[model samples]
Target: MNFPSKILEKSVEEISQLPGIGKRTALRLALHLLEVPKNQADNLANSISQLVHNIKHCKECNNLSDTEVCIICGNSFRDDKTICVVEDVRDVMAIENTHQYQGKYHVLGGRISPMEGISASDLCIFPLLERIKEKQVVEIIFALSATIEGDTTMFYLYKLMKDLKIKFTTIARGIGVGDELEYTDELTLIRSLQNRVPYSQDLI
Candidate 1:
């Protein structure tokens, strides 16, 4: 059956579409918004609208940015020689929160999932290779998840960049299998990075 008001039902439906938010939670949120002051709701809506309108992917690393380049890429203090490769921008933010990595980042956009039809060509791998070729990158730290897809992507990247004389490493196995980098605690992430081992050396 339809709700008393179409607007309220529409608002609840829209909110429910958000990740992890169910219809009940969406209705609660919609009701809460209605109870709040109009100015406050307007400000919240305006912030989301601004985010949707202003934010864009960084040209260099594919991270979210308001401008052409992300803040990390634009920063002069970041170590240009080192690049931390991650599955998504959320992982980038997680690592940044630890303040353990002063180097720049390259968001792969996603991992390679052959079953899902996502391949090397589908991700930002080409741009990364191009960046490595053109820039003086000394090391690449892979901070992808320990999932099957994540492992496949890591191996693909390693093989692709093996010809280059750059040092490549992955975060230590402290993060359990199936664990996502974004969900990992700050201390654990920092420790994993600090104890990162050489990808090739560890394999042997």
Candidate 2:
């Protein structure tokens, strides 16, 4: 699209690079930002800058946070003996919205996908093992997506800790096959978590 100013065109180009945002949407956003007060635009830019530069991953769960530890990890009342395993911060947010789980979390960063060259070693699996050992965790809830990669990751984790006397469970089939946890509605996610079943190879 032709632009009256090279600066606006540059802004649209950068914004369009974001996921789900096309050039037209980016142009509208750029125009909106241009029409807004200078301080308002500056605030938006500053927030993005802070998000990029000041964000830290929680040392415990690897979730995004502004401090060393995330608020959930720091909470004294969350179930310390139970850990919910998820793929990333987005999954964590999806579950947290349900407010049905009171346990801690272990973010795996990503699932094992041979096609994508993502192996167990590339994820946060080591830290999870250490957390289980150190905390004497009793129950592990596999909250990964309902896809081949998610199942593969869950199976790998189960095998790694099967002999440790810890209980293994997975979210119920309320989540459809090939569904990502992050996209599941809160009601379905809650039901799935509430009706979780013992982890079995058949489920995989």
Candidate 3:
């Protein structure tokens, strides 16, 4: 699609470069931004610029933050002994939305998928091991996706820490809280029953 203004075309092109954004959506967004107040557009541009320029990547957890340490890592109330290993910052955000976990996180950045040319060395696995050894992190919760890539990544991480006196567990995989048993897949239903925890009054 051709635009009257070259700037509009360029803006749409750049916006479309973002993941999951198509050219049409990018053009729509560019047009929407034009309709918004100048300051609003400026704020959006400035925020995106700051994400690349002014953001601080936490050395401890690789989380984006204003400081060297992220708020979660810096928070004293969070349990440091239990580290929830995840693939990316998005996973952290997803888990945080649940509000059920109070443990610290270790972002692997990406999973160990050879098809994607990503390996264990490409991730922050060494730092995790260092944290485990020096900080004495005891429990490791693999909160990754329940897929082939996620399973491969979890297995690789577990193998690395196998010698350490640490307890390793994957996030419980099964049907949702409100989901019907009949609607659930056979594998999910079986795993859910196998990893069932004792009934807790607090959970009710």
Candidate whose lDDT is highest: 2
lDDT of each: 0.90, 0.92, 0.91
lDDT tens digits by residue: candidate 3, 14-76: 999999999999999999999999999999999999888998878888877899899999999
Which candidate leads the pack in TM-score? 3
Candidate 3 lands at a TM-score of 0.91
Q: Which segments of candidate 1 are over 4 A away from where they belong?
A: 115-117, 175-204
After best superposition, candidate 1 residue 100: deviation in angstroms?
1.9
* Candidate 3: segments with Cα more than 4 A from true spot: 199-204
Clashing pairs in 3: none
- When summed lDDT is taken over every stretch of 10 residues in candidate 1, the lowest stretch is 195-204
- Sliding window of 10 residues with minimal summed lDDT for model 2: 169-178
Q: Is candidate 1 or candidate 3 better by lDDT?
A: 3
lDDT order, best first, reads 2, 3, 1
Model 2 bad stretches (over 4 Å): 175-204
TM-scores of all predicted structures: 0.81, 0.81, 0.91
